[model samples]
Target: MTRTLSRAACIGGGVIGGGWIARFLLDGTDVAVHDPHPDARRIIGEVLDNARRARARLISAPPVPEGRLSFHDDIAGAVEGAEYIQESVPERLDLKHEVFAAIEAAAAPGALIGSSTSGFKPSELREGATHPERIFVAHPFNPVYLVPLVELVGSGPQDEAILDRAADILARTGMHPLKIRREIDAHIADRLLEAVWRESLWLVKDDIATTQEIDDAIRFGFGLRWAQMGLFETYRIAGGEAGMKHFIDQFGPALKWPWTKLMDVPEMTEELSAKIAAQSDAQSGQHTIRELERIRDDNLIGILHALRANGWGAGETLRAMEERAFAQAHARAAHAAPDPAAPLELHRAKVGGDWLDYNGHMTEFRYLQVFGDATDAFLGHIGMDADYRAQGLSVYTVETHIRHLAETGAGANLTVRTTLLGFDAKRIRLHHEMVDGAGTVQATAEHMLMHVDTQAGRACPMGAPLTERLAALAPGQSALPAPDHAGRPIRDIGWPLGEPA
Candidate 1:
């Protein structure tokens, strides 16, 4: 069996290190960080804040319990007893070598050590290390907490088992780990990005375009396409059903054209540096870094959500993780059994900013959405899980009546409690109450669900096992008085008083 990572040590608390910290902590792994810089704590704190906000928006299911975080003044103390150690020191070979030595001295004997160096090959990073086989490169993208891709590379006489363990941990943390076949100066993605960066710098130095315009060219065009489909796939579509070979043949000669400055390097003189900085400032200097980060996060959330709906690219990753999370939550609920006196509290969510209406409260339709999620939870509890549904029998909502009792604004934490109102062989009635943190009723939904054989496309009786489970709950709920607003017509409030004119 593979060892499960529960605690990790971060050697540097800079941007990349902080991102690693956020990703680990959010995945329920305790983190110990070490950085000699005076402002390390503040920087890491800010990054964690941004990560938490983005995570709340990205994942709709309840998250795992957050892990504890501690800061250390020295690398030895940070890596003490840590099962995994990550070094994110400045991208200098000597600095990384020194940090890795210290980490190897302090971390557990078999601990997997990863370096966040974007350019250095793993062989260079493990040059003077005692445990070179344990060292690998786990380069991650900026905003490591959100971006899923991580490039994993191992150096000289690599231990395949160690790399497999590292990849497993990364995957569990909601990251896609691409194992590099051989050592390279800059791993796959960055090499491609560096090429683009080199060309963009030449464009800026030659005064052909400003920073903003270059960004616009990408964002408004291929960037959106690349979000879900990569360069080859996008161009394949452009081939108009002929496929990638056709695209290559059609545009193959253009590759030789001097459209890009790939080989030539731009001199970054003080004049050019100042010009670039000023132009960048002019382009986006109005917002503070935090504000810009929020804007970026919002845009990413929208894009990821759209992709998730289509189940493509990064969206596909998000959807798979969410299903695993929901299944884990369901399993935990089953083990702890619901309290008979109170409605089963199985689902909780924070109102996301996108859920708010123009009036600044949660929209009406979202009430039904929350209730629907809660009902799904109830279905899972009574054995109507994904596996059960796969047998071609499942429950489907036939009718829903929602009553909005109070308004709740964005960021308000809401809990859903579901009560079984009644059930027969073919139908089950459920009442769901949505309450704020203070237990105030924010909304209520009464739903009727029909058990159906999806293959037959008609109502059907639930399995004997599920029926027995519901029968146990029906009696306890039967003793309770009916809700005051259980049955109400959708009509004018004063219809009887006004009468027909």
Candidate 2:
């Protein structure tokens, strides 16, 4: 199957489907979504809200607006012409089978169908489908829009290639897509999660610890290590330069002891589920889902930013992010102004850590923040400083659009360049570009800012004095060399910030 994607479908508009939308749309793929549940629209809208926040948290530099999201009442409407179909309905086997059947009937022959069921094997999911080979499993963690890992399992002929395609697509979604060798009940990641969960259940059942205690044990301990390097590599280092062989030799014998019950699978009694759910509620009784999502996005951004600082798995993610930011900044800067004498100071700013998202790049809002700062600085330079504002005057951005051309990583030196697009008595239209130390433009902000009176908080005219300064500045202002497509403001999708000749 062709790897290039145009449209994708998320068949369920719940949390998981919303995540799929977040992943694909943030990465620039058009998405069609369907859900029969009465609250699907509201649920997906909530998901999109979370997705916007998630994108802002992880992707430094603004991500392109999600490709058009078409909500459909019928499954066929969502699946038609979609290159990929992600099924994220409830966790019932029968329901998944029915959904897969519908997907098979609706999707084109080339489209790949992915089931987000955590426990079901692909063989079982494909049991009733006509083209079982096109179907597989793509199990993502909760708060799927933020977490990058997706456990992919494929069955039947050419399964490996299908899995590869899925992995590529997930990578484009900024996820760490893992392909397990064969089918298992819960696949590799969840199996690891299950092992810990089962042990946790045993602890809770035996009154050894509470739910939060188990969570603290993992989170405060090995979870930190696992994010950068997997368990085996960490253990190898823990072996003191003896390497994997020596490490295994020294500790392998402990496997025979009663350190863990490796073969145990806990029974999912209602009592156990209720106990877990109750504990979860007790832990987070006051926070709404949106609030929880913001918290998660904040923590993930912090952790990932730290990882990027140390050059971990998040580092690669960061590099990709920085490149993107530079590209967009360059594009926006390029189109903004007509020609000028020297570099225009759009804003002088400080970078914040919160601007770093899960991908360890700058967030979308910060890009505008920086651009706005740059514009303020330029206006100040041209005699629109606070003193000017002290006389009941300031600038307020009324309309703005940002285009993300490349990714930007944490701690990369970036500066904003402003080009005076045009100006009127009451408003100034400007373009701002953020560039890294290496002179790569990552993102651009085009804003329509209105003059305002600080005291009245209402629109005001640019005085004759400020207007003269703007004209003086405008004569010296010039846009950057046009990128490949000069006539259009938007650039090629996912285009790189090319090396300067």
Find the candidate with the highest TM-score and give its number.
1
Per-residue lDDT of model 1, residues 1-501, tens digit only: 223469999989887899999999987889999999999989999999999989988887667678899999889999998988888999889888888888887888978899898999988887988978899999999888888889999864445778899998888787888899888999899999998899999999988999999999999988889888988889989988888899999999999999988889888899989999999999999999889988988898889899899988888878876776666566555555877656889888889888999999999888877888788778767777667778999899999999898989988899998888899999999999999999999999999999999999999999955797798888777777778778665766565677752
Those runs of model 1 whose alpha carbons end farther than 4 Å from true positions after fitting are 1-4, 156-158, 383-393, 453-459, 464-468, 489-501
**Residue-wise C-alpha lDDT for candidate 2, range 450-479, written one tens digit per residue:** 988879878978885578877776655544
Q: What's model 1's lDDT at 5?
A: 66
Stretch of 10 with least lDDT, candidate 2: 478-487
lDDT over C-alpha atoms for residue 112 of model 2: 87
Candidate 2: regions farther than 4 A off: 1-4, 262-278, 325-417, 420-501
After TM-score superposition, the amount by which residue 251's alpha carbon in candidate 2 deviates from its true location, in angstroms, is 2.2
* Cα deviation of 324, candidate 2, in Å: 3.9
> TM-score for every candidate vs. truth?
0.92, 0.68
